[model samples]
Target: MTPLAWLAIGLLVLVLLAIGLGAWRLRALSHRVGSFECGARRAGAAGAPWVAGIAHYGVGRIDWWRLWSVSIRPARTWSRYDLVIAGREPFVGDGPDTYLVRCRYHGQDFELTMSRAAYEGLASWLEAAPPGRRNVVV
Candidate 1:
């Protein structure tokens, strides 16, 4: 092949390598981005829900959790999120109605960027015993 052709091929390879490296770096960075409002490293996948809380948050704020530990003799209950995870950070407004609470948790901070309406919809799930009542499942 001509010298010019070889040089062009080498330049193209270099460009490809740079692009690949940049992509890899971005992927790693995103993992630390958290959902959005959290500003911390995301511990789980974006769409991965608690499903059944395979693990715990392993956090120190367990004293505040108040799970509905009431045992109904023969009452069946529906499954739903105990925590509201959503929305971005630096919330401009005030009160819980302004943004979304993480609908679920992955034992990390919380999935953010949901919406006020979304948090309201979780009324049933929010019922629970109280906030930060249950111990960290981890």
Candidate 2:
């Protein structure tokens, strides 16, 4: 084979290795991060489209990471103290068991679409916050 062919083969091998490593990383993260898949959209933004992501519940906050991105940093985070559930409704066309929850974090509104069980778990997490740590506005 020519040198150019060898270079092409090396590049192909690198790409495959990168994909394998990424898959391994994602699987390990899922196991240790306790993350749940969900869809999110910011409220009041023009043509705000729902983006698929995973939510990782932390000690006093929740971090969101885009599902298809390679970045390790969270795309968004909401403190339990400032997060508030504004409303909930059935997520149209998703299913009966899925719901769309409207929430406010530091006055910024966003929506999360999750399963019924996940929604209940989120509610419980918020309500279980330590006393004096929550700032209930309503």
Candidate 3:
């Protein structure tokens, strides 16, 4: 084969590998222990859904991983102690079947939108806090 042909084949293989890896990661993340689709808006980026990611709950923290990124590392991690739900409201314009809950985390001052079920689970987790911690606003 020509040198150009070899280079082209190499590029094609890389593309296929990337696609396969991305698909595998997305599927794996969806089925992972505590993952949920959540939209995030930076404190400075209100009125815009700047990021969409998955939130995975750990023992005492929730890790946010970007939906389209290939990295296994979380983009942001929030500790339960530091998280205080400023408020929650029904998210608008997402869809009917799956209702989204828009909430603001006090410490980060950022907004996150996730499914109703996910929100409920978060609320339960917050409410189950041990004694001595201040109340969480949900």
Candidate 4:
């Protein structure tokens, strides 16, 4: 076979491998309780502070993936132990059904916005600390 033909075949194999790996990663990360449409932002955004993504809640962490990203790794993970629900308010232009929660994780403030159901689940998870321990949410 010509060298060009071999090169094409190698490229095809690499593309297939990438696709398979991406699929596997997405499946593995998505096999959880549920994923909710959410948005996040660092404490210091200028005009508005919302970046869209889907949040997957795991045992002790919440993994956030960007809405358009296909990467397996989470864009951000908020650990339960280091998370504090600072406050909550309705999602201004997003309608009353959607809400936003201000959280402090590892000393950095962030804002997460999600639907009522997702928020309830998050609150439950945060407050579900061990019997003797307590987590405050508002």
Candidate 5:
């Protein structure tokens, strides 16, 4: 084979190695992304806090009994959270019974809705988070 052809093969190998390494790093990082709950199918509220890069949207306070969230794009909200939002866009429900919440974050808008059951679980996890933990995305 020509010297040039060998060089090309070496370059390809390097590129593949880089991509594989990068993916492994990302997976490791996500594993430590932090989940509040143990993710068990329990009778009462018990769920994990959905992690996002946007720190501005997160739980403000977490107590044993209640949680307060300053959600910019709350997929669901609970009275316990004291969820602070501006407007409700449309009637796009998650389903026949569930309601959807469309809100903006970081100059962009997105919508998400959850069932009454899911919301309860989320609230539980958020409230259970220890104190002094700020809701940060990153």
Candidate 6:
């Protein structure tokens, strides 16, 4: 084989190894951070698309990261005090076990689609807020 061909093969191997390492890192982060998969979109925006993401239940806040993104920072964060659950319904086209939760944060509306278990966990987290800090609509 030519020298150039050998170099190309080496580069391909490096790319594959980088991809594998990234995947492993993501999996490890999810497990350690206790993140859950969810979809979100702005409720009043026209032509808005649902974005799949991972949600981490943090102290007094929920941190959301785009699922397919390479960045380590959260794309959005909602505080427990600012978020109010307006209603919930079954999310069509996903599955029977999935649910759509409508919520308001500082008067702005948004929707979250997640599995039944995740919804329950979210509800519990909101309801568990400390005394004198509980204003959630649930």
| List of clashing residue pairs for candidate 5 | 53-137, 54-137, 55-136, 55-137
Error of 2 at 54 (Å): 1.0
Candidate 4 residue 128 Cα shift, in angstroms, is: 0.9
- lDDT string, candidate 1, 1-138, tens digits: 999999999999998887776565444433432211111223356555322110111122211111111221211111233343343333343454444233344444553332455333333334443565432231
- On lDDT, the leading prediction is 6
- Of 2 and 6, the candidate ahead on lDDT is 6
Worst 10 residues of 2 by lDDT: 129-138
| Candidate 6 backbone collisions, by pair | none
Q: What tens-digit string does per-residue lDDT give for candidate 3 at 1-138?
A: 999999999999999999899888888888997888887876656556668888888988888988888897888888777787777776667764344443445545777778788887777887787876534665
Error of 3 at 13 (Å): 0.7
User: What do the candidate models score in CA lDDT, each in turn?
Assistant: 0.35, 0.81, 0.77, 0.79, 0.36, 0.84
Tens digit per residue, CA lDDT, model 5, 3-121: 99999999999988877765664444335433222111112222433223211123452211111222223323233234322233233323454433343333344433444443444
Provide the lowest-lDDT 10-residue window in model 5: 37-46
**What's each prediction's TM-score?**
0.27, 0.83, 0.87, 0.73, 0.34, 0.80
Q: Write the per-residue lDDT of candidate 6 for residues 27-123, one digit (tens) a residue.
A: 7557855578889999966478999888998888998887766677889999997788888989888999999899989888999999999998888
Once superposed on the true structure, which residue ranges of model 4 sit more than 4 Å away at CA? 1-32, 44-49
Which candidate tops TM-score? 3
Residue 71, candidate 1: alpha-carbon lDDT? 22
Would you list the rank order by lDDT, best first? 6, 2, 4, 3, 5, 1
lDDT head-to-head 1 vs 3, winner: 3
Q: Once all C-alphas are superposed, what RMSD does model 4 give against the true structure?
A: 3.4
Give the Cα-based TM-score of candidate 5 against the true structure. Answer: 0.34
Model 2 stretches with alpha carbons more than 4 Å out:
132-138
